[model samples]
Target: MNTPSNRPAKGKNRAKLDPVYDLETRERALALVSHGRSLNSVSKQTGISRAAIRQWQVRIEPISRTSKCSRPDDLATYSYLLGLYLGDGCLSRHPRGGYVLRIACADAWPGLITACRDAILRVRPANSVYLVPKQGCVMVTGHSRHWPCLFPQHGPGKKHERHIALEPWQQQIVDAHPWELIRGLIHSDGCRITNWTTRMVNGERKRYEYPRYFFTNASDDIVRLYTDTLDSLGVEWRTARQSRRAQNVSVARRASVALMDAHVGPKY
Candidate 1:
C-alpha cells in the first residue's frame, strides 16, 4: 500500500499563521494603543500590523505603560534624529538579536551626546541607550528590532559609497520639520564660522567680519538633500569643492546666515 503525503493536496491551500511577535514587542504595541495611539500610528512606528494590534487590544487588558519605548508623537524629534543618522549614524546587527543604531558625537560637545541619547529614547522608548567611548568621540547607541522599520535607509556598505534617499513618510516628516532636520544635520556635519577681511574705509583699513555656515559631506545625494531643503526654506547656499570628492555647501549670504543663527546655532 502507498502512504499518503503529509503535504496539502493539489489545488487546495493550507492556512498559514501570521508571524509571531515576541512578548516585549507585543506589549509595547499594545501599550501604545492603550495610551490612545491609533492602530495605524502604532503600526507604522512598530512595524506591527494593525489587524494584529486590534486583536491584541480585544484580548488583553490595558496595562500601565512606562516610557520604555513607543513611537514618538513629535515628528520634529524624529526628523532631527533622521538628520543626525544621515549625517553620522549607522545601524548594525546586534550579536544578541535586533539592530543597533549608533551616532558618533564628538566628546567636545557633551550636550550633543545627551541629546543623541534622548532622541533615541524618544524614537524608541523601550530600547536601551548607551554611550561607547572612542578615541575622540562617543557613540550614542540604542538597540531595537524596529530600527529598520523607522529607518529603512540602513543597508550594507558605507553611506557615501551608496545611494541615500528618504522614504515618502520620511519626506513628509522632513517637509513638516525642515528646520529640525537642518539643525540635526548642522549639529552632526556642519559648522558656523566667521571670516574676516580688511577693507579700505575712510582711508583707513577696517576689518569686516562675515559669519557663515558650512555643511560638508562626501555623498552627492546627501548634499542634494541639504541644498534642496535649504532652497525650500528660502536659505541660499552655494556648493564648493572641499576636496576632489567632498563638497562643501556654504550659507554665506547675510540673510541666510541670520536664519541659520536663529534656527540652528553653533553646536554646543
Candidate 2:
C-alpha cells in the first residue's frame, strides 16, 4: 500500500484554494471603500486582498446603479418619510462613510415600526436598515450617502432650535400626498384620544365622550407647517397650551375630527 506524504502536489494534482470572508467583514470593507478610501489603505486596514475587494466592487456596482439610478417612484412614501423625519427622525454621520437616518418609534406600535422600516426601504432601497431597541422605543435606522440630499432640512442644531423649511420639490410632494404626510406625522408625534365629562341630560347625569386629535411639538416652525397643511385641507385646528413650554395643535371640532378619522385616525 502506498503511504501519503506531506509533499506539495505538482501540475494538475495541485488543489486551488481561495479565502472565504463573512458578510459582515465584506460589508465593513465596502463601507470603507464607499467613504473614498484607497484600495491599498482599505486592504491594509481590513486584511482583505485588493483583488477580492475589486471583485466585490465589480459585482455590486450593477446592483447599486440599478437601485440608485433615479429618484424613488413612490412619491407618497417619500412624503410620509419626510413627515416622520421632521417629527422624530435624525441624521448622524457614520464613522465609515455617509450618514445614518434614525427615526424613533414606540415599542408599543410594532406596526408603526414596520411601516417606518418599509418607508425607509422605499426611499433608499440600496442602503441597509436596522432596528435598534431602546428603553421604551425602537430606532429605525438606515445608512446612505444621499440622506442630506434627500433631507435638506438637516442642520447644525436641533430641529426646533433652528429654522425648518421644505424645498420647493418637497413642498410639491407634500401637496400631492398631504394625507400620507399627516398620517406619518400623527404616527410619530400626534395622537387621537377620548375626553369625557358628566352633564345633566333628561334630568339625569350623563357622561359624554369627545374624541380629539392633538399634535404637540416644541418647534414653532414645525407646528406652523403642520397647521398650514391642515388649513389647506380644511381641517380646523387651534394652538393650545398644555404646559408652560408645551404647545399642542388641537383638533376638537366634530368636522375636523371626522376628517382626521377618515384620514389619520389613531396610531396603532
Candidate 3:
C-alpha cells in the first residue's frame, strides 16, 4: 500500500490560473482598495490576490474619484449617473486644468437632487457637491478630472444636435442596469404622474384619472433609446405630441405603468 497516491510531490511547482471577475465584482474590489483598505486585507476578504488588487487599483488610479484611486463600483449607480448627464448634465473646464460637472434636476423632486449629489460623491468624493437653484430646477455640481471618462458624450453643442451614441462599455453597463438608466432619464427629462380628465358617462359628467410617464427630449436618438428600453422591458409606449423642436414619448396604460413602477417610481 506504499504505492504513490494521486498527488504532486511536496516541492513541485503547479500551474496557477488567474482569477476571472465580472465587471461589477472587479469594480467592487477596486472600490474597497480606493477607500483606504489595505491590499492584503482586501485580498484576504475578497479572495483575490494582493498583486491583482494592486494592479486593479493602479489601472484606474488616474481617473479615480479619490486621490487614493477609488472609483464608483456599482453598475446601476454609474448608469444612473450617465442618464443624469445625458438628460441635463453639463461640464465646465477650470483654468487650472480639471473639469466641473453639473446635472440639473427639478427642485420639485428633491429625492432626485439628493440622488445626483450622492452619485457624484460616490465617484468623485473629494469634490464638494452642492445644489444651485436655477428657475425651477436644482443643479447638482461638482469638479473632477475624469468626468469625461464617465460621460463620453460631452461635446460643444447640445445633445440633440450632436451625434449622441453610447460606447460599447457604456452600452454594456446600461444593458446590465436598464432600469437605473431609465430612472435617470425620467428623473432628468421625464415625469411619472397621474393625468385626469372629465368624460360624459350615462349623460353625466364623470372624472377619470390615469397614470402615465412622459419623457421629453430633443434628441430623436435618445427617444429611440428610451423606447427601445421600454420594449426590452415589455412595457408599451408611443410618441406624444410636443413642440416641433422636442420629441415627446409617453408610456401610458395600466399594465405598463405597473411594470414601470416596479423598476422606477416617481421622484419624490
Candidate 4:
C-alpha cells in the first residue's frame, strides 16, 4: 500500500508528521520483526502484524538466522503443522531429509494442525521432529480426515456419517513395505473397494479404492486393525505371510501381486 504522505497540514512540524504511534514504537517493532520475530510475536508486542512492520521497505532485509518460534498462537499453529508433518499418509522418510504433508482437509485443517501439534508433542517431544520444506522423495498416501482437527467434536460433517480412515502413521506403513500390503485374511465377497467421497482441500483429483491392499502386511496400518480387533476365537481360520500352510489348499499364493492384477488374474 502506498504510504500516506507524512506531511500533515503545511505548517505541521516534520517530527509531528510521523504516524501518531510513539516515535520509537514503529522502529522497535520493525527492528524486532526484521530480526526474525514471527508475525504472532510482532503483533502481540506492537499490536501490528509483521506484515505491517515490513511494509516499510527499510525493514525488508533479513536480520537474524533463526526466526522466533515462540508465540502463544504460533506454538499452537506450528505444533499442529508440525504434527501434520509427522503424521502418516503424507510424505515419508524419503531420499531427502523428509517430505511435505499436502494441505488436506483445509475445512478444519491447518486449524487442526494447530491442535494436532499439541496432541503429538504430548506423545513426542518437539525437538525430535525436524521441519524442512519439501525435502523428500518418498511416496505418500492421500490423507483421510477433514482438514483441521480429527477430534470427534470436529468430525468431518455435521451429520458425522463417516469416520476418517487415514491413519496418522499410514505413511510409515507405505514406506515399510514399499509396494506390498498384508492383512489378516481378506475374505471379502470377491469385491473390494470403497467409493467414499474423499474430503480433499483441493478438488482436482480422486481415487476410488476398495479391498485395500498394501505391499507389506507387517505395517503400522495393519497394526491399526490388529490392535482394534485383537481378540479372536481359537477356531478362526486365516492365512498370513507367517502361516506356512492353509488347510485343504494347494500351493500357497502370495498376496504380493498388485491389487489391480489380483482381480485381473495371472492371464490377460
How many clashing pairs per prediction, in order? 4, 0, 0, 27
Each candidate's root-mean-square deviation in Å? 12.6, 6.4, 13.7, 18.9
- Candidate 3 per-residue C-alpha lDDT over 36-68 given as tens digits, one digit per residue, 9 for 90 to 100: 778888788889888777776667655343433
Candidate 2 whole-model C-alpha lDDT, 0 to 1: 0.86
Candidate lDDT values, in order: 0.85, 0.86, 0.80, 0.32
Candidates by TM-score, descending order? 2, 1, 3, 4
Most accurate candidate by lDDT = 2
Model 4, TM vs. native: 0.21
**What lDDT tens digits, residue by residue, belong to model 2 across residues 181-248?**
88888888888999999999889999999999999888888888899999999999887665655469
Candidate 1 lDDT over residue span 16-115, tens digit each: 4457776667766876776677889988988888988888767664422421334468799999999999899999975434678999999998888998
Best by TM-score: 2
Worst 10 residues of 3 by lDDT: 62-71
Native-referenced Cα lDDT, model 4 = 0.32
Q: What lDDT, from 0 to 1, does candidate 3 have?
A: 0.80
Q: Model 2, residue 44: what's the lDDT?
A: 91
Candidate 4 per-residue lDDT, tens place, 91-120, comes to: 322221122233222222233333333433
